[model samples]
Target chain A: MINRHKNLREKKGNFWEERLGLRAIINFLRQKKVPLSEHTIWLYTGSLILLFLAVQVITGIVLALYYKPTVAEAHASVRRIMTEIPLGWIIRSVHFWSATGMIATVFVHMISIWLLKSYRRPRELTWMTGVFLLIITLGFGFSGYLLPWDSLSLAATKVGTDIPRVIPLIGGWISKFLRGGEDVGADTLTRFYLFHICLLPLMIFLLIGFHIFLIQKLGISHPLKYEMRGIKVPEIPFWPDFVLREARVWLIALGVLITVAIFFPRSLGPQADLMAPTPAGIKPEWYFLFLFQTLKLFPSQIIFISGETLAILIILLFLGLFFFLPLIDNQPARKKGKIITAISVIIIIYAIAMTIWSLFE
Target chain B: MKFKYSCLSRRRFLSWLGGGWLATFVCSLIYPLFKAITPPYREPDEVVLLIKEVIELQPNSVKYFSWGIKPGILKRNDDGQLIAFVGVCTHLDCNVQYLPEKRKFFCACHEGWYDENGLNIAGPPPKPLRRLFVYEESDHLIIRREEKA
Candidate 1:
């Protein structure tokens, strides 16, 4: 059977294949190989992210059909979808869970790449694009959260938008722009709905397309340490072997998503009242917990600069460093590279610790 | 005696079963997706209103209400008669505004116009504004889809 499949291209004057010349693309995929190692499992995380994203897009479209962008009807519309529309709760639940899954997978993929030092010299652009994609994914989460127009969502968005106000010169303008006014009200809902359903999707789609294209063109990166030591990595064809393994992973993920969505569906809170005081324990989504906690830990003022401003500046500094990391540690075999990796590990630990503390508090 | 079914090997059978399971799983999602995408049925056959809401409505003026998800208008004709209209434009679905000076229902969307009597008189409106029968009782008014015979 294997031999017959191998001889297919050589033997056939297949009509469609001849006309379209898809043979080149097919041959490229067949020739493309993935490095088989203990760390190969991390490579599968990208495909998992893709799977969750596809789930998000499909469910999101179905949701938008029922969702109302206006402040007057957004909450009521969501309620109607939950209680009145058939299986609407399931669709919404899946959308929410899939978003969580996608963001989680994205974090895993990035951290694994960092640990393996796969974002070295030739793959700098790949790492940059990955960081951009991460930001876009988070943006999707943040914007989508406000669409429900529940008290919790409104309060969280209020705090989230205010974070930008701590920036230096353009801070006030940025905050106003994000909120579409001085407050998180009617215009904010309209703006967030636009971002969630249209702008963010377009940006993510284009970036994901380019990100995948870069990945395929450069081929999968080998572990930096392994490459430096001249180790021969075992490999398997991406077309059949790697693809079949990924398909199994996708099936398992889908099953888990459906089960969790059904059993632990997200619940909507009371409709947001602009005149009401913010509900207590107001927190952003889980992904933003660490940052939220970090911001909370800062004092009201820090000498000349405000505490929140200082914190935001520091966060921005770290983000800049993270984006330009490949250039900083251009040579992964050096002592500087080891130090950078160690710092990244510490950052991860800090983030986890902060997230847990915030959850408890 | 041992008998073997050559046409159905155990490996092939299991593969077929796996494929069938996957196919079934995919097919199961279709109904929920269809239900979600296809909006709920909400054709408003009639709506009821308090007479006091429109009691002070002046002639050549319009009072707005909701007909299901669409805008509705209750206008008092100059001759002291009440007329109700589904305020959506016939060309598209933009809400029509009553221009008192012109005394015509105007859709800002495409400059579509309907006469005071709800007749399509100008612009892109292919049909007249939908008229609903308004019935006045003791203290309430009922707007129905059918006109009085």
Candidate 2:
């Protein structure tokens, strides 16, 4: 019986091999090895992010099946999905939690890569691609937030999209393009819906593919200290060993996601009344709280320039520097790298403190 | 202490467990997609307000009514004739409030304004408020979508 089962499997495998030449790819996967170290756990976050992205894509498709992107029907449709559609609440909740999970993992992945100084030497492009991916993921979150057309989302989107208007030349145009007009209305809803579903997904897919290709081309980075000490790290094959470990991590992440989604399903706010006063103490999504707080810290005006414009310019400058971090810190074992690492730590702490402070306020 | 099961080794058991989870996961993904794609039947677009509801609307005054998912304004002109307009701003669809004293409609959002006849008058309103065809039946006032000429 076992022999028959094995023969059947081999026959099916051969049939596919004959048609599509998957052998070379399989062999490549078999040859790939992951360096196991004390920091190996951080490597799991990369795949965890991929897993959550898969979840987001699947659940988002399910949501788009029922979501109506219009001023009148958007809120009502979300309500219906929550209350009427079979198991739709679960799908929507999963999508929500998956987005949150994905963004969180991206932050972790980026931070770990930064702290480990893995973006040193030839891995600069990989780090840059990863940063771009993070930005695109945030864009996905921001765009998706407004799709529900609830009062909170409406208000938050109004504030969020207005941030870009602080730039000097194209700011107004950027805001206009984002809103599709002067205000967040039906056009904004349709535009954000298109962005969340189509443009961002397309960009992320291409970028993620390229990012993975680069990661493959230049294998995963080892810790700077490990390299400096010349400590040989043990390696395991990617085909079965690392893949199995990664699969286990994915299972745990999935379990947590499901539990959270099921327990604290997202609730729909009342439909947005465009003319009604903005809700008091309105807040953006948790991931944006730090930026939100920072924006709030600036007064209306500062010297000659508007506080907001200054804040936005400063943020943009930092972001530009962050993107080119690999070029900035050329030596991983030197004083410059230590300073950059200290700066990164300070930024993380500031972000966390700001997020907490914003939550309280 | 070393006894092994004849039907299920550790490898076979683990594979079975993984396969079971994989099957469950795939089904979970498929179930929501299947349930969501089958479109829900929606009610036909029709809203009729009873005449008595708006009968008390004084001349040169406006009363609010539900026009499907949107709001509508039923205005009684100084001539005591009834005209209805969709209470949504043309500039950027906000609920417009009628000012009986001013005999005009005001959109708080973007400060858009429309005249008593729903014509764009001031502020950022580029076009007039949408006018609905108001038909008086024996007992009801039916508001229908305006036909483009």
Best by TM-score: 1
Model 2, A109: alpha-carbon shift in Å? 0.8
What docking grade does candidate 2 earn? acceptable
Residue A96 of model 1, lDDT score: 94
Best by lDDT: 1
Q: Could you give candidate 1's fraction of true interface contacts?
A: 0.62
Model 2 DockQ (Cα-based): 0.34
Task: Give the per-residue lDDT of model 1 (tens digit) for B71-117.
Answer: 88999999989999999999988988999999989999999988999
True contacts kept of 2: 0.54
lDDT of 2 by residue, B1-149 (tens): 65665777879989999899899997975776788777666532546888988888899898887786688888999899898888899998999999988888999999988889999999999999988878888999877775424
Candidate 1 per-residue lDDT, tens place, A26-97, comes to: 799999999999899999999999999989989988888889999999999999889888899999999999
- Give Cα distance to truth, residue A4, candidate 1, Å: 24
Leading candidate by DockQ:
1
Query: In candidate 1 chain A, what residue range of length 10 has the lowest lDDT sum?
Result: A9-18
Taken in order, the candidates have interface RMSDs of 1.1, 1.7
